[model samples]
Target chain A: MSVQERKQRERAERERLIVATARELAEQQGWDAVTTRRLAERIEYSQPVLYSHFRGKREIIGAVALQGATELAGALRAATVTADGPRARVAALARAYLDFAARNPAVYDAIFQLDGGLAYAQEDTPEPLKGAFAALQESLGEVAGNGVHAGLFTETFWAALHGLATLTRARRLPPEYIEQRVELLVDRLALV
Target chain B: MSVQERKQRERAERERLIVATARELAEQQGWDAVTTRRLAERIEYSQPVLYSHFRGKREIIGAVALQGATELAGALRAATVTADGPRARVAALARAYLDFAARNPAVYDAIFQLDGGLAYAQEDTPEPLKGAFAALQESLGEVAGNGVHAGLFTETFWAALHGLATLTRARRLPPEYIEQRVELLVDRLALV
Candidate 1:
């Protein structure tokens, strides 16, 4: 490889480190605690180095949100693709989506709650987000029922999963009822 | 009225004022700006007086959450009770839930997101919260489908409304799709 290509590779690696560090910091401490100074210190880089990579905290959050979206898309795909039937796939999708939210709350917050300087539900939306939704739609389309738009069906079902995740994470919904809630959702909403 | 009765009424009024002031402050500048010092000043009450009414910030948030719950319950009931059919009632309920979240974001956050020190989904959960769920259940119970548990069904539907509210609020979903999303949810999920 050329010398310039080697330098580009190193820069890409640095960017990943920065995003991963930001996500780890955010999860360990809430977003409020993730100042640029703290992030720079933890990553063993000078403030200027970190600034050169990300404009500030918002950009860092956006990077994390993107990575999280990709991870969520992968998790959902893995959960649904192997399921035997349409009903089983929808149930698997719901559980996987909620589990992603519960496991990576800080990342979830970045994607759903905090300002990540990202455009959504638009042609210019980040690839990872669109991918995440597409993963859900792939499985949900089969059970969308006749005459219903598959995208709309996916949006509604995704919202239900989002609700379950956020509410469950907040402890507003009791944990014991999680399974029953999933069952009720699939039994009533999924045409299969 | 006797002086004791008058004092009791005055105290209740003062508590209401505190909650309202906090809600207004939170709405205008977000929750972080609604500090105790700012709250005491807004209510024209001494810090000690504010303390006498409630323990601290957590209690104040709890008070706001309870008030919001009561208000949401009223709104949902008013929207659904007069709708012409089960499908219409469910759609109206979804609209009302999203509208409540959009109109009173701070209050909605207190009830759903922020640490309000409120019990939920348990036998000892607070009254206003229980009432709010029942308000949703009243309409949702009609369209829960045969052999499905009403409470679980309501929980799932409520989660969908919540997901739509939060996601729409965050602009993760485009605004133009709002009505279509609601229509799809009602048509596909409701047994009607």
Candidate 2:
């Protein structure tokens, strides 16, 4: 490889290492404990070296949120693709969304709660954020009635799923009834 | 009043002053700025005196969450009572919820996101927490189909609303479509 190409590859690798380390630290001790100093120590790098890759903790969170949005989109696509019917697809999507939140609480918080400095709902919003919403709309559009505004319906459905994930994580909803609740949401939203 | 009664009343008044100061600071600059030391200074009380009322920052957050929950329940109840039908009631409830979250971002964060040591979904869950859920469920029950489980439906509906609120606050959803989204949610959950 040329010198410039080799250096570019090395830079990308270092960025990956930093994000992986931040994710591990956040998962291990929660987001509050994942300070820039702690992250540098964990990765055995100087704080300045870490700063070269990320502007600050918020930027690191933004990186993580982007990674999470990609994963969420993939999961939603998988759930929707494998289902047999529109209602089943919606139900699977809800379950996948909730399951992702349950498994990655810190990442979920980064994407949904923390001040990640990522632009949202604006023309300048990052591609990953738009991609995630598109994934949901693709699945939901199949169920929304013809002549009905699918985008609006998707927004409401997405809102409901987000609520369930947050409420469940907050322990506001009983754990054992999660499936039934998802079913209810799908059934209600599916019927024309 | 006797001397003991006067002293007790004075202490209660001081506690109220402290909480009010904290709430104002939070509203002005967000929750991150509402530190215990800042609150103490704002209330013109020593750190120890503030601690006498609240164990620490987390306890103060819990107090704020409780207060927010009470207000949330009142809003939900008012919305439900004023609506002419089940779908209208649910729409009203959703709008009220979004309005509350938008107006009291700090208090909403305290109840939903911050670690306040408040028990939830457990046998020992606090009354305010249960009261908030009860308020939502009471309205949801009016629209939920016969044979649909009340708790499960309420949870699903709540999840959707919560998702919308958090996403809107995070700027993940467009603000202009909030009313339309609520209408879609009500329609999806009610007769369509």
Candidate 3:
């Protein structure tokens, strides 16, 4: 209720607007087209204001990546919760993961492909990144098979899903039979 | 050889030199550092000379991708030929594939990550790309399991390997336990 607290809230809102605009611009015209100047222009703020919110584009990318990771975690959890069994849950997780990649490719690239200047799989990794991994682990660890480390199994399975999403997007793999590929991946990799 | 034959040979040699120079520069200083002007200077040729061999950077990437594919095919075949059984051969193939990606990061990017003006998984795909896929298929198709199409199985397996290669390189995954991951992938995915 204090004046300073209201100002802080406004600052946070402006930061969100900047990130949303950047994501929208990137989605419309790939990451290369995203520049601080253009982002400032689109948000109707001075470059200084944009800089105050983010050090530069790398930081912006990191912000987007964090947001994407959080969304990805939610999407994966949602997909799995609706499925009936372990196998179905795993399959749903894969579908949701791929669908996310296909639909929001720029955001996916920010999280995985581009240099978002974010640490990963380490003690100091950001909470959103860790949360995304934990989401996968929750569904996949149950089916990690006997004697396989759940974390390792989740990493391997995640890598496979990442590959499918990437190759399909890159046109390295044909789009046809994607469903079959997912079924085969789940049927073979999951212990259940 | 006749004068005409000698001229043809010399032209082919220059083309090779251009491709090699571009690849070397890319490997040393990521692909972003590669440009027609830099490439011409490195090869001791003019920009026009470089252009004569390929239309532009995209075509140059295609050439590198083709070269990488040929090398990858050879590496995979070599690794599997010495292995004892289907399971061992598949493991060897996975290791060799990953090794190739690690050793030739830029070339690997050219083949998979960069826009190389290349057609993939299509009838009109370049010969070297097809050869590389065929090499993987040779070892993997045998263990595709009953009632599974060999090509589909090979594609799925290839995507998993790709995910591992890409994520490991990007530092998204921890470096340790790669060998175990490979073993788990082969054991679980292959019917062997």
**The best candidate in terms of DockQ:** 3
Model 3 regions more than 4 Å off: A1-7, A46-48, B1-8
Name the better of 2 and 3 by TM-score: 3
lDDT of 2 at B156: 80
lDDT of 1 by residue, A1-192 (tens): 699999999999998998988899989997888988898898888888888988778888999999999999999999988999999999998888888898899999998888889999899998998999999999999999998888888888888888988998888887777888887777767898
* Residues A1-192, model 3: lDDT tens digits: 699999999999999999999999999999989988899999998889988888888999999999999999999999999999998899999999999999999999999999989999999999999999999999999899889999999999999999999999999999999999999999999999
Per-residue lDDT tens digits of candidate 3, residues B20-132?
A: 98899999999989989999999888889877788888999999999999999999999999999999999999999999999999999999999999999999999999999
DockQ of each: 0.71, 0.81, 0.85
Candidate 2 lDDT score relative to the true structure: 0.84
Top-TM-score structure, candidate number: 3
- Evaluate residue B116 in candidate 3 and report its C-alpha lDDT on the 0 to 100 scale: 96
Candidate 1 residue A92 C-alpha distance from true site, Å:
2.5
Q: Where's the lowest-lDDT run of ten residues in candidate 3 chain B? A: B44-53
Residue A48 alpha-carbon offset, candidate 1, angstroms: 5.8
Q: What TM-score between 0 and 1 does chain B of candidate 1 receive?
A: 0.93
Candidate 1 collision pairs: none
Q: Give the fraction of reference interface contacts each candidate recovers.
A: 0.91, 0.95, 0.78
How accurate locally is residue B164 in candidate 1, as Cα lDDT from 0 to 100? 90
lDDT of 3 at B48: 92
Q: TM-score of predicted model 1?
A: 0.88
Residue A46 local lDDT, model 3 = 82
lDDT of 1 by residue, B5-63 (tens): 99999999999999889999999998999988889999898788888998889999999
Total backbone collisions, model 2? 4
